[model samples]
Target: MHLFELTCTAYFKNDLDFRRSFETISHFITYAMMRGGLDERHTKSGYKHYVFGGLLPLEADKVYKKGSTYRFILRSPDEEFLTALSTALRQNIDHPDFIVVETHLNRRKSFFITELYSATPVIVTSEGNLFWTMEKNGDIMQLQRQLHDNLEKKYQSFYGEEIKAPQNFIQMIEIKNRVPQNIEIHKEGKKIRFFGNKFRIVPNEDEMSQKLAFTALACGLGEKNSYGGGFCLAGGMR
Candidate 1:
């Protein structure tokens, strides 16, 4: 896996609302891919092959101020996608009125993933509805099953292979937030939203566990990852 840190130097022509920045950045990425002549990749249906963090600020609240610098992190296992994205950004990134002053790449492999925390909310749903902790009377096993299944599906989709499923490789875990949060994104003059929650996960000591952890780190944990949901930060990365 590889991570690209994009340093954004802000020169806001209008007030940039942080609340709406996720959707804005998502569109910017689409434009970048199209500009780079990777429109087919961007429009493809399965596994967007990238996950990104929110546009972080140097110091600010809801609205970003001019003359300030900010940044965001994007990760992927696809070298081609990353290369195209970097090339596009270098060519032009003035949409949100921010210039891509710098781009840093960090390469990561399957290291011992001891702990994982949600950098962005993880959106897990069942039967077209959001999964709540109280759905099965706070059953950790049930939640773990869903999580494990989701990881398996994503792994197969991205790697084009079936991984030997370890018996709940993601062991006993605690969710940091009991209350689910909603992440809203605007598209085509309509508002799209998903309910998600953050988690503090611990992986079991198994080879398959290590593989799944790396997949979650590179591809994200749950659904709507292309919109920046389910981005996780693994512990013990060097």
Candidate 2:
């Protein structure tokens, strides 16, 4: 499979509380997509087939400085969509909160990925319930099953192929922050809330395993990906 990455550098126009900035970033992306004549994709139903990360310069204070350049990433297996997004972001250079100063796009083969890290929290859900911790689920095995199943479904949906008998694709490395992070977004005049956890993940050193990791990195790990949940970073590829 093929994957595309877009990195955006912007100058913050105001002091933004990074802790609660996902909503703002989501809107910014939607607006850019709309401006790029992707109104249907911006408003259409079902999976958006793309994912995004939060603003860069990870800070403890959770506040961003005004006029400082910060970076964020967006990835997808759809190159056409990403190309339009890049063009739209570049054309609409100014915004009330930030200015899109630069954007870089790179395409890569999915198999080139050697490492995958969740740059944003991954929201895994089962039977309309959010899976935040193992304690809530009663065991780690159940959580692992849910995570793998979720990724497997996403992989099938994205590629239109089912993975045959295989080992676990995503190997949990570490949960950087154990606490659940809350993501609230305004949709249709109502506020929707979701909880997720940020963690690092690697593959099982097999081709199929890496393909699954790349699916998560390219598309997203769990639900609400268009809102930036499950955004991850793939490394060790040149």
Candidate 3:
């Protein structure tokens, strides 16, 4: 099933910037979902979004690119839709997080991804629990820094190597939020770049959108149902 059903509903707080609020959204959510499963009938400015596979839906979303793009705006919720939304979120966590466009941030009449935010899924296990983050941009950056510092502390406490830049982190909690700020294709034509964060692209000739959407789904990107089933709160990234 498409991760989000239209029944989802969600809220957007005014960001650190006072002029506007995070875009409102509603959609169904599926975790660790693979995009090759969905339908890619939709196209964004000539890109395939959702395409159909046998029984599953191929993913349609991808990290936003500056020129080639797939963009949608999150609109405010009206009364009736808002009420029905409360029941929807409990069905799953996908309805709560989204990499939606914000108007004020874009500072334009049309949509642009001026902001990137998500409410990702978390499964607590013995290794350590993981959680989604909703932080002011600065805070998120700081938390990333702390992760590096904590790594250093651990190394120093045990290993004796001199401190250096942290190693690349393995990608988890996929976010095809913003399109890559840069791109490069290799021998097999696989490409990689950044959305709100860094990512790699798999190659596919037949269905371009399908390829991108699959990338998004694999990375756990897209809109969520607003019913609030999987709402996550991080320990402040900053």
- Top-lDDT candidate index: 2
Ordering by TM-score? 1, 2, 3
lDDT for 42 (candidate 2): 77
The C-alpha stretches of model 3 lying farther than 4 A from their native spots are 1-72, 75-128, 131-196, 200-202, 206-238
Better of 2 and 3 by TM-score: 2
Winning model by TM-score = 1
Score each candidate by Cα lDDT.
0.73, 0.78, 0.25
Query: Candidate 1: lDDT of 71?
Result: 78
Query: Candidate 1, 146: how far from true, in Å?
Result: 2.4
Which regions in candidate 1 have their CA more than 4 angstroms from the true location? Answer: 1-13, 58-60, 94-97, 131-139
Error of 3 at 14 (Å): 9.0
Candidate with better TM-score, 1 vs 3: 1
For residues 41-61, could you state the per-residue lDDT of candidate 3 as single tens digits?
Answer: 111232222111110111243
lDDT for 38 (candidate 2) = 93
Tally clashing residue pairs in candidate 3. Answer: 34
* lDDT tens readout by residue for model 2, 1-238: 8889999998888988875578878888888887789999878766788988888877678897887888988889999999888889888556788878789999977566666777777787755475566446545555566667777777787778998528777556666775777678777998878877776766677777777777888888777888889888777655
Extract clashing residue pairs from model 1. Answer: none
Per-residue lDDT for 180 in model 2? 77
